[model samples]
Target: MPFERVRLERVRLEPWKRRPELAALALLLGLLMMLHSHIPNIAGVGSLVESLLPWFGVYVPVLLAGALWRRSPSAVVALVLPVTVWLSLFGGLLTDKSHPGGDLTVVSHNVGAGNSDPSGTARQLALSGADLVALEELTDQARGTYEKGLAKAYPYHEVRGTVGLWSRLPLSDTRPVDVVQGDVGPLARTKPPESAAEAAAEVRALRTTVATEHGPLAVYVAHLGSVRVMPSQGFWTDSRDFGARALTKAVAAEPNQRMLLLGDLNGTTDDRAFHGLTSRLTSAQETAGNGFGFTWPAAFPIARIDQILVRGVRARSSWVLPETGSDHLPVGARVSW
Candidate 1:
């Protein structure tokens, strides 16, 4: 009887001693999150991985379940590595950071060009109570609708190419920004003698100075090139990364001290491609928002591709607005000089 009992105890202990592969995988996940920046951008896959990096946390529960089912003590102990790493990376975002009032409220929305109801989207934006609004992906037919719909609340507005800015205050020094990767600024930004349709095709970014009571606030509106993923091409970020590099140069050369960039940057702040932008400007959502504040795919947001970055102002609060006809959701930020 004693020998049989000893054999049964050993059989039960076998599982705790096995499944080293599970423990190894847990450690690998930790390393991936901890040293994600070190991963090369080979074929832009790194950017894609980093873009959805937050979702990596989902694996924690998955692995935990496996560990429990397998009765592997090593795997259970290994889970602490990934859990700690994930919390360290995004733990701050799990908390609320918003404060009360602000000097100005700004909203950025990439109203999809395929939108069926531009007028309705415009009406919703007008009701957002934003002092300034930046819009992207505006089609020629819908441009007039937005202009007319927002005329009452926003007296000053500028439309250059597909991007536009509407402000309750006065606007000046407004011009298109040539965000073509290697294109020279002076030549690229110039609206040459071309048809309105040609201008719309060529321009996707703009900058303007809003005359506020406190002082002049330089605002930049941009819709960087889109990204795509394919089985053959993997993460195709060539155009978007090109635009990012060019936009970084433009932001570096900006003379205004109080500057803000509002747009659909096509990637997250964690993306290495936007290191230049993130290094200089701070994201309002990350600074003062309630949560991850994902603003893409209005039906079910999963990532925060849209951004409101400030250089010389304080972001008091940030939030995502109610969905409109557009595919992308509108993001708002409250700021003070």
Candidate 2:
């Protein structure tokens, strides 16, 4: 009878040994969790890996479910590493909350430039009832369309370069900020001529301040340079890294006590890229949101690239708005003094 029991135990463990894929996945999960902080600076590869980390939380559970289905003890134990890592990173998001908070309402959206239907996007954002709206990736051609579509609801608006801020409250002291795109001398000299016949368009970074009822709130709207993937290295997310650093320095220098930053940062708060902003401000979603709140490539949002960050304010509630024509989703948050 003892010999028979040993045989049964060995038989039960044999299946896990045969399924190498499960073991390999477990090993990969462990490595990712252990080395997450040491990820290389490769452009495309890095961004792709960083973007996929949040999804790992789901993958680990699915793998564990498969292990249970197969009755593999080895696989079941292997899942614990990733399960612990994922839960440690995002466990708090699972808790139930009655509501977030009550002072201010803010929204952020990328509003893809190639969007076939700007009017639809505008309508969706306007209906969100956000007190302030920040939009990025605004092209010259589509600017008027958005302005016209949003004018009725957001009476006060400001546009600096490619980014714009529209507010129901009066906006004042708006100005463009130099975000270290390139040589300042050449960029300044290349400006368009005063006369139409000799005019030539020039590139410049976008920034602005909005005067809100809460007080003079300095709002910064930015669309950082995109990171791309390549075969040689892995992924390239450096442009965003540099842009984030520059934006951070600028924000630090600003004298305003109440500040709000909204943008398609192209990275999550977990990423070190936003350390400058994250360290100083409270993420609205983190404080008051209910779910993962992913908001990129509308076909399937795997990450939350768009964000609403605040300093010297309180967040009451936050949520992702319904999708519109743009490839990105809109994120909104309500805050109080």
Candidate 3:
């Protein structure tokens, strides 16, 4: 009876030799599940999956090599589904830059707190000729340097907390926005300044009206609270989620239809936590950029946390600028009114 059981187990294992194509197909199906992140959102793993969704296309090359080695037409055929799905989702972005000529150009960057050359970074950004520049992670030490460096190009600017906005056009009605809830830090408590010049020193998120050629445009600059992944606690997105909810509510209540939001949201559009903002506004890069345009960890950008989102206005083109002193690469978008 023991010998018979061993023979049955060996027979089951040997099926791959007889039908390798079927086995490959099964593997492809599993890959498909991972590609779509069909798994449940248990303990916040689902958000992680969505964050890495674009990279799943990396598997296609490996699968193709396996199909060739096995000489299995069935295995090759099985790859078509994933290929189609991937192409359907990201193919347009791989194509050439089609749209051009924008009424306004906007740039956003999270100049790392450890940035070595704040003035140089500011100069580079100012040279981009962006009508508006939004910066996050602004430190007290580097703030004055950036302000001085950019003063020539961007005469009008505002900073609230760690986030700031610089514009070539006139700005008005600028006020600190309450995005993050819970522990209200010193960053969030900006005293009402007696003058416009000192107003930004204390602000984290700000809503300002930009006077454009077309009309007044509402622009919101924010640096949402960061998130972390801990072995014991899982994805720690509580602060980010809270800020998202608050920002969403503020944007929803805005009377202006032509609004722009630029900053380091610290979460991807695919993450459900950002649906509050994504559902209302359109991402500039997703709408018009040529490629993935990832813009974090400047050395090797794996994700795009910095964003340019617009409502009513149209994004003509969106792209990432060259590397800077900061850890995050700057992202820019050209929009038409």
- Reference-based lDDT, residue 103, model 2: 64
lDDT tens digits, residue span 1-337, model 1? 6999999988877745558988999999999999999998876778988999999999989998998888888988998999999999888899999999899999999999999999999999999999999999988889999999999999999999889999999999998898753543223345463686775567889989999998999999999888877566677787788789888988999999899999999999999999999999999988999889998888998899999999999999999999999999999999997
Per residue, candidate 2 scores C-alpha lDDT tens digits across 1-337 of 6999999988867654436678678868867965676776444444466667777777777888787777677777788888887778778777643274576788989899888998888888888888888898888889899999999999999877678888988877777665534422212235435763232112123555666566777888877767565455445566667678888888888798788888888888878677788888888888788887899878899888888888877777888888888899989888777
Task: State candidate 2's TM-score.
Answer: 0.83
> Each prediction's TM-score against the native?
0.91, 0.83, 0.85
Sort by lDDT, top down from the best: 1, 3, 2
Given candidate 2, what's the lDDT at residue 229? 59
Candidate 3 Cα deviation (angstroms), residue 147: 0.8
lDDT at 264, model 2? 86
User: Which is better, 1 or 3, measured by TM-score?
Assistant: 1
TM-score ranking, best first: 1, 3, 2
Instruction: Report lDDT (Cα) of residue 55, candidate 2.
Output: 79
After superposition, candidate 1 runs with Cα above 4 Å error: 1-15, 181-196
